[model samples]
Target: MNFTGQWVAFKTIVYREIHRFMRIWVQTLVPPAITIALYFLIFGQLIGSRIGQMGGFDYMQFVVPGLIMMAVIQNSYANVVSSFFGTKFQRNIEELLVAPVLEITILLGYIVGGMARGIAVGSIVTLLALFFTDLTVNNWWITISMVLLTAIVFSLTGFINAIFAESFDDISIIPTFVLTPMIYLGGVFYSIDLLPSFWAKISLANPILYMVNGFRYGILGVSDINIWQAYGMLVVFVIIGFSVSLYLLAKAEKLRT
Candidate 1:
């Protein structure tokens, strides 16, 4: 397609995705905010009183970034996976597949839409945290980059999930089993430094660990892993996810059938 036509397609997909979530604001946005508040209540106020500081910050302060990033990751993944799968289920995706828009354009459009929701929810969670704890951002660049990269990587992962999904159950499986375990065990509550040596080594293997630590570093100026390693892993996932999603889009894999 020509430049003008491509731009139009991009805008259309983005508009649709944005409107999809905006139309259901309570469903798409409010739950995460409420969930974060509960975390602060249960973990931060109730349990945190006993647990004390983590990474040299008050327990509530230490957990905020991880919670925000968690919201971003989940929402970003859910937005794309459910939206794309819904399109496929409803037979609406055929309209785009038959169009002249480049596969990457469609991917980017959906990705941006997913990231938009992710960032928006993350921002809301951050604001909510302010009510429960005093906070400071130690590294603005790390904070912004990590949030954006995390959103993009998960957005692509969700797209891949959508492509492989044969039913709504398939789409929900990864988030329920895989994604939940990763986020919970991803060092959201305590630093890996607090773990025993063997468990610490094991925790290092989780990709979400790097993301949480990196974001924790951004917010609290403390991290259990090297910031470079976190940035490197997130970048690698973004590259790999983008490539795979593009290929799936080009092939029109489960989407076309």
Candidate 2:
């Protein structure tokens, strides 16, 4: 496709995905906001009060970044996985495969759409959190960069998962089993500093921990892991996911005969 044609295709896919989620705002957006509010009330207010401060900030402030990132990660991933799999189940993806547009463009377009929704929801959650606490961003660039990169990584991941999913239940497996555990143990509720020496060392192996703390450092200026290392790992994941998603799309891996 020519530049103009590519632009049109990209815009159409993104607009369609955006409208899809926005039209069902209750399902796509409101749930995460409500969930976070509950977290603030229960974990931050009730349990957190007894738990005491972590990494120089109040419990609510420490968790705000992780919560926001969690929303971004989950929604970005869920949006694309479901959106792409729906197209596959309906056989609509064949239309894109048969079109003159390049596969990389198609893949990137959908990923961008997912990232947009993720960032949008995360931003809303952040704004909502502000109403309950006085939060400050220690480094705007790192914060924004990490969030964007994390969204893109998960968005691409969702696309890849969709390619391999064979049923509706398949789509839910990763989020339920893998993603949920990662987010919960990802240093969201407590600091690694408080963990036993052995457990703290083991937690380092969880990649999500890096992202959670990296974002926390960006907001609260503190982290259990090196902030730069977190940024590096996220960039690497983006590159790897983008490359693999492009390859799958270009080859029409599961979509074409």
Candidate 3:
């Protein structure tokens, strides 16, 4: 397809994705905001009071950025996986395959859709957080860039997961088993510096740690991980995720044909 044709296709897919979640805002958007609010209340207030400050800031402050990142990661991944998997389940993906749209255009459409949800949910979570603690916003660039890039990475991964997913059950497995564990341990609740020398080293292996800390640095000016290294890692993941998602998507189409 020509550039205009591809652009039209991309917009259509993105509009469908945005509409899909927005139509069910109660289910897709509201829950995460409520869940993060609970985290602020229970962890940031009730427990944080007794625990004292973390990473040189109020406990609530320390946790706010991580909570936002959490929302972004979860929503971004969920949006794409569910949307794309639904297309697969309904077998309308064949329509896309036969359509004049390029694969990259389709991929970008879904990624942007996922990004919209992630950023939207993250914004909601951030707004809820304001009721609990003030965000000084140490660096606007890092804060904005981190959230956008992080959302993109997860969206691509979600696209990949959808490509390989065989059943509805398969889509939930990674979020439940892999993503949940990573987010909790990803420096959301506490700094890895608090970990013992040995465990702290192991924590570095968890890629989510870098993202959480990078974003944390953006708001609170503190992070357990180096900011530059975190950006580097995120960039690398973006490249790898995009390449892999494209390959898997092509493979899936070939198999479907």
Please report, in order, the local distance difference test score of every candidate based on alpha carbons.
0.92, 0.89, 0.92
Residue-wise C-alpha lDDT for candidate 1, range 150-194, written one tens digit per residue = 999999999999999989999999999999999998998889888
lDDT score, candidate 2: 0.89
Stretches of candidate 3 above 4 Å error? 253-255
- Model 2: which ten-residue window has the lowest total lDDT? 248-257
Q: What TM-score number comes out for model 3?
A: 0.98
Q: List where candidate 1 sits over 4 angstroms from the true fold.
A: none
- Please, what are the lDDT tens digits per residue for candidate 3 over residues 171-252? 9999999999999999899999899999999999999999999998988888887899999999999999999988777676
What are the TM-scores, per candidate, against the unseen true structure?
0.98, 0.97, 0.98
Q: lDDT for model 3, on a 0 to 1 scale? A: 0.92
